[model samples]
Target: MEYTEGVVKDKETVIHVHPNDYEKAGNSYLMAIVAVIAGMPLPIINLIASGVYYLGNLKASYFVRWHCIQAILAQTIIIPFNSIAWGWTLSVMLNKTEPTLYYGIYLFAVILLNIIEFVAVINTASRVNKGENVRWIIIAPLTDKLCSKKNKSPYPLY
Candidate 1:
């Protein structure tokens, strides 16, 4: 584990980070993006890749674990929405199902959501690479819950 403590300057968090660890933490987000593209049809691939990365870094510092968990959580959130869109797309293409107005609306909503997530991912990755931590709205709190608070503990209860 490699890390040093720093105040996030926001009440939302107190970051435990190491400059040396930033690259790996940052790369995790990029990894998620790559996984998503590589498995475009399978929304689960990004989540699975994040899980594997998290597992591999079980003994990593708190910063790395936090980012990994955060990235994974984001992937989890995207999966169901992406899966639904993908399924509907296939159904429309193969089954010749009529596209309802609701379908168009849903697709638009999903695309917006995906774009938001994508921008957030890129921003987080870039910031982390620069030794800056970005705590997301919902995912940060969730990640903190899953990741240990103590500097010496990488994963909680492990």
Candidate 2:
């Protein structure tokens, strides 16, 4: 079977993915976005849905696996922030507590962050769909470590 490989040099390793793999990989991110939008009222639902979608794609090709893993990891990082925002909003609603400037600012910031993430996801997916590789400054190391080749140890190394 012939495999397509993306070329990356000079501190970047580009893994090539076929069109099918590219679509599959991009679908993972899209799934996360859908989960977020659909589960907006309940953050836990979003988390579970996104987590399932992300994990389900891990067994794909190197390119797809890396892209999906990165998306999952990025979602994991954002989950806590979302939880905090949701909790604050819920508390304010249940207690009838007046919302403060701080709360407003924080909510605004969270919304901005989410918007940025959504844009990034779309951009990355588009590039990936076009056979272009995308890199995340924050998640790059984790993706590299998780996707790195395992060392061959013939000396019974477990």
Candidate 3:
């Protein structure tokens, strides 16, 4: 294996293990657009649904109970709308008849949206993993010190 920039290439074919940054950035932008177009509706729906649930069912803490209810509401609303939009875009693209300008634009938008979504997910996942590792590193020692102070044990198991 040979390394070029941050990418590892196969010795025989020179195929890169990591994609180029520009490509990744382009994908990330697309993902952000998809998130905005497809995902923006959910938060509003969640707020409404959670508000209703919180008011109707007053047994649990509104803040804590609303989180789960909001997630469910968001999923229910987002999935069906997203699926219909995706299907409509696909059908227009796959149609055998002469494609209209608007159809072409719609197809392009859907493809671009998906690409953007892929990039965003990749970037977010990478950042989250990095952040989580850093957090754990910082937290572990603090947790140990707190536990040790409370229990009078120098070594914390966890």
Candidate that would win on TM-score? 1
Best by lDDT: 1
Worst 10-residue lDDT window, candidate 3: 148-157
Assess the local accuracy of residue 98 in candidate 2 as a C-alpha lDDT between 0 and 100: 75
TM-score-better candidate, 1 vs 3 = 1
Tens digits of per-residue lDDT, candidate 1, 58-153, equal: 788777888899999989988899999989989998878888998899999999998888888999999988888789888887887898856554
Tens digit of lDDT per residue, candidate 2, span 39-136?
77765665576568656754556666777777777787887888899999999999877799999999999889888988998888888777666788
Task: List RMSD in Å for every model shown.
Answer: 4.0, 5.3, 18.0
Model 2: lDDT to the true structure: 0.72
- TM-score, each model? 0.83, 0.81, 0.30
Ranking by lDDT: 1, 2, 3
Q: Please give the distance, in angstroms, between residue 13's alpha carbon in candidate 3 and its true position after superposition.
A: 51
Pairs clashing within candidate 2: 5-16, 6-16
* Model 1 stretches with alpha carbons more than 4 Å out: 1-16, 150-158
